[model samples]
Target: MAETSRQIPERIPVNLIVNGNRRTLDLAPWTTLLDALRDHLDLTGTKKGCDHGQCGACTVLVDGRRVNSCLTLAVMKDGAEVTTIEGLGRDGALHPLQQAFIDHDAFQCGYCTPGQICSAAGLLAEGHAKSTDDIRELMSGNLCRCGGYPNIVAAIQQAMAQS
Candidate 1:
């Protein structure tokens, strides 16, 4: 018979409400929320860019507020509600922001689209943007190397107008 592998004793227990589903995980103390989502939970929609908070490609919503997932520790967000790009939609339909992004051609390389949409969703929920400039200013963290800022802003504006 094969011997069982040793269990990691230092792993911490964490509970999360991810995409409206309860998830329990035993993670290392230093595991970032982004790694937990992508590696452990298999939710790769939350990307890993720069591995730092400076690049908002790893943005996700924690308890309805947008956060940089790369810098946040998994244990810190235990019991929190996390929403990734995959969970942004409902009832077999794309999210309004997602549809708006498509309509406005908000992406060039498409790498930053997920984070852009997630940030846009949180921006709308935050209700801090009153104009186009406000949206541009607020969404500065998420960067697209392909220079798609104009279209990204347009998508956000469209979603805002529809809402």
Candidate 2:
């Protein structure tokens, strides 16, 4: 081992309100929102599937909008409200989408469940999905490798109905 020493850049300050908690973090400007959430904040509910923004597994709500966290830099979301899967519920109760996923058996491996639910919540919030087909189209970004599309749609529909 040649005692390799690599220079690390200085971390910049970024502020965000995550899961209803204000967080101040010092991180490299190149750090992605997904990395900031999972690596720095220990909020691992956001997954990194493609790291290229092709997969919605890293989806999160930034200022009430659905975003691919992996493609977004931490500094880009500074002073923004970020919501991960862990923030969807309150009072020890599951969010409607979470419960719907359980009731509809929307997940198998469950790896993409968090992103799916978050995306669904954003979909509902956007209020653009008027039909199942619309939901399918809007949620096409979040891919479920287990082929649980039907159940996932049903879960979203259930959550939408409840809303």
Candidate 3:
């Protein structure tokens, strides 16, 4: 009988500009961006509601676009600018969306707030939503189990108007 050798998975290097900070990490090829952000880098602001990408609680900005962090592989986003909820504000000043969320009470449980804010920022940047219906359609991906859609839409509308 002949013995066969097993292959060992190799670690891949991933470079990401997160929250205005550059990070280089050597991680397993299978590591998801959400895991890298939450587990490795300790950026837990991105939630893990449903790892399958059905829920947008793990949403983040990759290269200025909203993406489900859990659905994106860390190695695939090399040289990309990644922005999580923690990156949205600076020096105790909240981002416009963040302030809007607060002003409108857009969150209740707060588990989905990060993703909601990130998605709203992306929507505003896209400049496609002009009405509450459009905002709802664009932000439908981020689910708040607390059922804060009305306030969420209001917050986004307020932020959009201000922007």
Candidate 4:
């Protein structure tokens, strides 16, 4: 029995603060945060693209900042607060940014929508620069290959103006 138990790999325990909730999980050390969120906890709002951190598609907010989940190790984020696109809404109401995206037509194909939205949320929280140029510069990390940049900018600016 001891030998049989030793044959099974052990999962590393981690505490994740996700969307304002604390969760403890036993996961493989090699798992990425992306997989932990989507596969384990069922937060599917963060998209996986390129899987190499080049597409900026797996963006999520960690401790009120944006990061590429595909590049982040699950075990390394122990007790770190993580927020996905799902966290932006409240009680079935759409976040203003979400509404703005809809109003401005900020997405097509929609595969990149989650990353774009989450990145914009983090951008607004930073409050570093106000000009469109600055927004463009800060948002450079997130890419929308579907040519949704203009509308995405419009939606972000609109939400900023409202907030």
Candidate 5:
């Protein structure tokens, strides 16, 4: 008889600056950032749509850049700053983009709203989008099943103009 040995996964420490707060978590190396945010930190606004990188529902900002949380491991983001839907607003006030979303009616069912908003923020910060076509092209990664592309583009454009 032959005996086989199985290796056990170990929990590793990860330090993240989430929503302006430093959060230290012990997570398995395989734990995704989406799981860490939704499961461990209780930040559920960042939705899990496809669970794959194909859908941008789990999009979040890591160090001011947009990222697919489901595609990246939490351990890989150690010491990085992470921002979710919950972090966009401040002092009980909505961010300009959030307000623009509401004013433009950019969401319908709202499942993909968070990711769309986050991606828009990143796009705005990148300062490359100059027209509606540019906004649409840049925001193509974040899909809205509700077919809210028109309003989404308008909202982003309004927000960009205001900023």
Candidate 6:
């Protein structure tokens, strides 16, 4: 008789409420929230730039606050509400900040758009100052290699003024 090999442990079950939808995924405990969102959940709006938290491209909102998805473990976020860039708009309508970004040409390469928008959305919600210095300070974390800071800041300021 041939001996059977033992099965590996199953992935841990986690519940993540993303973009107003509840998702159940079986993922490895070591999986980061970024990977779970991009790989398993297929929410690619959250870009993985540095993956070490040095770059803010993986930024998302955890319970309406900004966070680096790559820095957070998938298991740690179980039952938590996560908001990706995909969640920022409604049916066929862009969020005010999103439209502002487009209007201001905030991005050049566009890779950082998702993170930039996500971070800006949170910053505006925080009710910070509308000065260029404050906007630059708050948005410093989300870097654009194309040197699009001026446009990015303009977009945020425009949205803030309108709001």
The C-alpha RMSD in Å for every predicted model, in order, reads 6.2, 5.5, 2.7, 4.2, 2.7, 4.9
Tens digit of lDDT per residue, candidate 4, span 4-61?
Answer: 4344456899899998889998998888999999999999888889999988889999
Q: Alpha carbon lDDT of residue 83, candidate 2?
A: 97
lDDT of 3 by residue, 28-98 (tens): 99999999999999999999998999889999999899999999999999999999999999888999999
Better by lDDT, candidate 4 or 2:
2
- Give all candidates' CA lDDT scores: 0.93, 0.95, 0.94, 0.90, 0.95, 0.92
* C-alpha TM-scores of all predictions: 0.94, 0.94, 0.94, 0.91, 0.94, 0.92
Candidate of highest TM-score: 5
A best-first ranking of the candidates according to their lDDT comes to 2, 5, 3, 1, 6, 4
The TM-score that candidate 3 achieves is 0.94
Q: Candidate 5 clash total?
A: 0
Q: Write the per-residue lDDT of candidate 6 for residues 76-121, one digit (tens) a residue.
A: 9999999999999999799998999999998888999999999999
Question: What lDDT does candidate 2 reach at residue 154?
Answer: 94
lDDT, residue 47, model 3: 98
Question: What TM-score does prediction 5 earn?
Answer: 0.94
Candidate 5: Cα lDDT at 102:
99
Q: Candidate 5, clashing residue pairs?
A: none
- Summing lDDT over every window of 10 consecutive residues in candidate 3, give the lowest-scoring window: 6-15
Model 5 misplacement above 4 A: 1-9
lDDT by residue for model 1 (78-121), tens? 99999999999999999999999999888887888889999999
For every model shown, the clashing-pair count is 0, 0, 0, 0, 0, 0
